[model samples]
Target: MRALRTGPLLAATVATIGVFLSLTGCSVAGDDRPVVMVSTNILGDVVGELVGDEAEVVTLMKPNADPHSFEISAQEGARLRSADLVVSNGLRLEEGLQQHLDAASAENVPSFVAGDAIEVLDYSEGDAAGNPDSHFWTDPARMIAVVDALEPVLAGLDGADSTVISERTADYRAQLETLDDEMSTAFAAIPDERRALVTNHHVFGYLADRFDFAVVGAVIPGGTTLAAPSASDLSDLVDAVDSSGVRTIFAESSSPDRLVQALASEADISVDVVQLYTESLSDADGGAPDYLTMMRVNAERIATGLST
Candidate 1:
């Protein structure tokens, strides 16, 4: 068994990683087909595109696992320890697995936080660095930041196979750009009056900002699923859904929709809790098997929900 010890540079890096992980998840892997452990399924999809068969990827959080509520199992701890590298989305989105990341760092393995690559949106009254809006992928443009981070890291890792990594990353990035255009066109079709979105929570702020939609409110009310909505919060959201003229409330495929439903009923608003793949992609057999497919599906759902 490999022992866990950290040198000064690695120590500092890990400490910095912890801060970002507090805001979201982090990931890392090795040069010769890194054993990449990502915090969420969505991230796994993106990494899959870059690493392809070169890396053995494991996503701890399942399709429906709540990022905040997900707990790493004892077996998963072993996996983290054994991984050659780890890659996670930085920013406190994966509240559940930060501890495991810490453990991996203690093992002197380098871990990465993808969110640190992008300029974060600070939604709080203060804290200019950003108040942890972990759902940046909702905006395809912001995801370009993720892909940018992804390409270089992947290139460095697969030195011998660097050509393939660079080419594939470029191709994937181009596709992301095309998807961004498609989303823009699809969203443009939504009437301005109906462009306001009411979702399960504030996951779509970046997406709304990207496509010119106003994010009214969320059913759960925050970035992580750690906090459930209070009765007042639900009532207020239902009222906001009514006042904002958003006839539908978007539900993340990963989170619960019952509360959103009850709130809509209480408000007597014709709110439809439409499911969209957000944090996690659909299962392998499902339509959204990768990051591109996942984002496209969400855009389609959002466009259709808002239009109809």
Candidate 2:
């Protein structure tokens, strides 16, 4: 497991080496509506939908980037501090960017943390057990909670149109409700015995909890992708995979599947590897371009992978 950085060290790192945003840009101080800087693409999509044209939503993470380790450019870091509002997944999901977020808070930029809006799931087992799982978007109900939490936050933003925000929030919430039902229906088709998951990392705890699947184990031992599995870790997971009898091991679009593939080779039984949009949204050309589409596409892929 990776050594957990102390909060002070993280803050010092942020002060010294901030999340590097690659894009060049001056701060948007002249916009009529508040400029909201969101840390990840997933939150960017959902918040963009709710706020619509009410605010300029500048998302820091690029499409399909790993949220756990992606950094912002110094210019982007400046924008993060200067923005009217900053939004982050929180609960330390933004592993590399926590310092910059802390700096933003220190600078007094009003911010919203999506993690605070819903029930948090901790790793049920492994070295990182009892640590909050930051991938709560897997469960649409939690996202609904995020939407509920974000509405008032958006309403409070400078120059926010409360009525438009309210109307759009309602529309998006309905869409999420529809998505939750769809995911539940899709997962219901998989047998109870087949509902076990092995993945790149411990990213699907909320999804497993939401839909009644068991997280057999992860390729990495912890909640963050930065942690690599040891030989013993891989050996233990291979044993679990063999006993669990799951046909497929899921990999995230953002993370490398090489570890998962290596694990498959070591398993006593043959197990296929399937890719899912576990952590980040993909580009527009990819399958999961937005939050709703992401969940729907992931559900279909998971159901097919488990049922077959």
Candidate 3:
């Protein structure tokens, strides 16, 4: 009886030790994956899709957060510096996180700027006129360019499978091409007179440039959400809105729509305010969870809002 009890105790002890070692091994394995830190959620989604299971992507910005003003914690800053690669939207977009990015770069962390991949457009009519616009993801074609530039860089990372990255890149590029075609078709259906756009800020320069829509005006005076519109600026935009006969003004999901609504009210003509996912993506359950979905939703919303 004593020998039988002792044998079962020994088996139980060995099983407990094995389970603990297995758990510890899993943690180490996860940590072994290369860390790719991204500045914004939108690019984070893109990088995550490209890397798949080959790397661990840590996005600094949260869902539906403003890229212009979002800040990171100390731990996040540490991670950024320690990452094998860092990705950001350049052209002075991430005003809040610029310091941390610079710190990481100083530490010799490899970096990729999405803005460097595309033909940058200037803010034509705002306080930021002549400044390069950082909202290139507004146009699907531009995003395709970003994916093209990013593929080779991601493949070059140690521990990343170049073949897998290339395959995923091809698939994502196809989806972006399809999205561009669909947006073109939808925007084409709207009459030329009604294709004017007004927004809370200068967030849609790329989209307007791509789809042949005229930017009537913006409630805010600059390209960033951090800028506040003066009363004179609002008055000027209202006049522009009245003259352009812009029936719908699009507001960004990442920004407050109050200013947009106020602008619509101040306009001489009746205007409808529609919200778009312009800057950042939403949570998984939100309508614009991924980059592709976010663009699709915005395109449909713009088409419908302008059409009506």
Best by TM-score: 3
lDDT of 1 at 264: 74
Q: Highest lDDT, which number? A: 3
C-alpha lDDT score of every prediction, in listed order: 0.76, 0.90, 0.92
Among residues 3 or more apart in sequence or in different chains, the pairs in candidate 3 whose N, CA or C atoms overlap within 3 Å are none
**lDDT digits (tens) for residues 41-104 of candidate 3:** 9999999898898788999999999999999999999999999999999999999999999999
- What tens digits encode model 2's per-residue C-alpha lDDT throughout 32-120? 78899999999999999999999999999999999999999999998899999999999889988999999999999999999988988
Candidate 2 segments exceeding 4 Å error:
1-30
Q: For model 1, how does the per-residue alpha-carbon lDDT over 72-167 read when each residue is reduced to its tens digit? A: 899998899887668887778777788888888899876778788877775541121247787788888887888887776666663236677778
In model 3, the runs with Cα more than 4 Å from the true position are 1-22, 29-31
Off by over 4 Å in 1: 1-32, 124-130, 158-160
Which of candidates 1 and 3 reaches a greater TM-score? 3
* Candidate 2, RMSD to the unseen true structure: 13.7
